[model samples]
Target: MKRISSIFCVALIGCLLQGCEKKIDLELKTTTPIIVVDGRVTNSSSEGSVVALSYTKTVKSDNSIVPLTGATVTIQEGNGTVYSLPEVSNGVYRNASLTGIVGKTYHLTVVANGQTLTSSSTMPTMVAFDSLVAEDFPGFGKTIKVVTPFYNDPPGYGNQYNLSIIKNGKLIKDVFAYDDLFIDGKKATFPLIYSRKADEFKKGDLIEVVMNCIDHANYKYWFSFSQSSTGSPQAVPDNPISNINGRAIGVFGAVTFQKRSIVIQ
Candidate 1:
């Protein structure tokens, strides 16, 4: 009798567990497409200002963007001088005549599909670096060499910086930005952090460090964009706020570029 009771209890429990299982199908939400505009005007005359236009894609779709063509792009200075940017390639526009000038504000306007978008940015003064040094630093379980650039923060508040590292003429994708909030009016040094050992400088590798003195808006965009890109648990991932007006998603940057190069010794 005890064995029969135990067998009945086991059967009852198995039937209850089987009854509780169900499959759930969730409905995914879709959104309308938003226009994306990425354009920049730099102080370098040789490297002209360029703009690329595209639209957002759905989450379920393949991650390919459709490049927009036949759009009219123009840039204007604060003094009302306008330069038209011609389409060089599909969805890409360039204006070699629109060289960025320090302390001058630049305005960008784009007309596409009967919609207009606009943005403005001011080119900040260039901050000169003192020197670039490659020094040996203690790493995890070993010593490694890193490249650092030394510069004095200009004697003012609200100064922002963006740094880029190029190895053998290719730009690294690491995003580096700094603000003079705490280190105002002080000499600062920054380390170029690379992810892989293969990216580290060799004895004779040519490295170029390009620094841009950007405005506050540009600094905010880069800082927020980097945080969203890192996939951090603490970060609230969202699109970086666009400097452009209208329902567009992108930035119009006017930056001053200064570069320093060094061969690893």
Candidate 2:
């Protein structure tokens, strides 16, 4: 098992990048319907987890972190236990004594003004690596369309991921997926893509891919990060969800969400 992991996903963007119009019609202002509070835990270990909460910027506004000054955040454990989390800092809640143990269930709730938002699921055991294979797209082998396939044991959510291409143990290129997305009101985890970034990888090299997943807020931030990253677009798979199990619920981040992970293949 690798010491760390990463998740891959996409976010719903409002404003256009480079002033180019894209998804401009899908605008959800603060007064529209819901407020999405993305809470994903990345950089975690047996020691502790540092989770983050983020939101898509207000439509037509610059990319800025929304101030969650008075918002109340709470986490619920399995067996219907509840604990209120004080804001450790801006948009962050730290449970110094709380550690994410595999197999135990957890739920998060954030209340602001007169609104309440919640989601929950159990954590999965850590996943091990598979392999990263590089192949050229049909009719485009030595040129334009080179495809890199990253596979891992238990090819699904809750498992962590990161990609590394090494030359003589020297770092060549690495990619990490931010696997936090609202699929049917649950948190989803997936793999990352990094073929186009490095110009020096081939079929005989050791190319490793990393993967993992976190909460919705972390998912959205990573989604935005990927969109704003300086490279070609790599899209992550979205989970199937209902109104009750969505990340972006009524006037909140999302409604229905499954935090658990499973094997895909």
Candidate 3:
């Protein structure tokens, strides 16, 4: 009798659960497209300055980017000299003669789609890279190899930096931003952490690192963008802080950088 009672109860519960089963379709809100500007000026004569324009993507639309072309782009030095960046390709403007100078400020002006946008950034002094050392670190049931860079943070506050990694001649698409909040005016060893089992370092692998000394505004933009991209718990689902104003979302960074390469042994 107890077995029969249990079977009946189980049948009754199944019927109740089937009655409660329902499908839910979520209606996500779509956002309007906005202008996105990516511009950079570096303190290297061998490299040219570039400003690329594009339209933002919406969830319902295709993920392909729509480039903004035929717009006026110019970079003006603090000394009142302006260099018009000619369009080398669609939606991309470049000025080969405009190299950033440390301690000098640069202003970017863009007129696109009948909207004007402008922003300014100052180039900070270059910090010397002392050495690059590759070390093995213990990982989850495996050994991980990473490159550690040694440098001295200059005295005073507000020193910001961005490091880009190039592995085997291909740029790693990650942002590594550092600030001198804890180790101000002190020697420090910061490790470059890029964990990919498929892209792990092997014998004779070449790794190049570019350490850029950027200003405070640029640091905030990069740090915020990194946090959002990594899906941090504290990150808000919004665009990163932009220095550019007037209907555009992006950053203009004047950076002084140094590059160094190391081979994994």
Better of 2 and 3 by TM-score: 3
State how far residue 191 of model 3 sits from its true place (Å). 0.5
Q: Kindly give the number of clashing pairs for every candidate.
A: 0, 51, 0
The candidate that achieves the highest lDDT relative to the unseen native structure:
3
Q: What is the overall TM-score of model 1 with all chains considered together?
A: 0.77
RMSD, every candidate, angstroms: 16.6, 12.0, 15.5
Model 1 lDDT-worst window of ten: 19-28
- Model 3: per-residue Cα lDDT over 132-178, one tens digit each: 88999866468878888889998886677888778999877566777
In candidate 3, list every pair of residues with a backbone clash.
Answer: none
Q: TM-score of each candidate?
A: 0.77, 0.45, 0.80
lDDT of 1 by residue, 1-265 (tens): 2124223433444366444221111122445666777788999887779888877554234435677899999999897899899999988999987889898999999999999999889999888877888988766456777789899988877677877788989876566767775567888776766655666677888989988888766765555555454332112225554577776666778998778999988
Task: For candidate 2, write residues 1-265 as lDDT tens digits.
Answer: 0112222232232222213211122243543432434353322543233234445444333434454556777776677656666777876665655555556667767766666656654555554333333453433245332324333344344332223333434543333333422232233323223454344444455443324433333333333333332221111112212111233421111111112212121
lDDT (Cα, 0-100) at 212 in candidate 1 = 83
lDDT pick, better of 1 and 2: 1
Sort order, TM-score high to low: 3, 1, 2
Candidate maximizing TM-score: 3
lDDT scores of the candidates, listed in order: 0.72, 0.39, 0.73
Weakest 10 consecutive residues, lDDT, candidate 3? 19-28
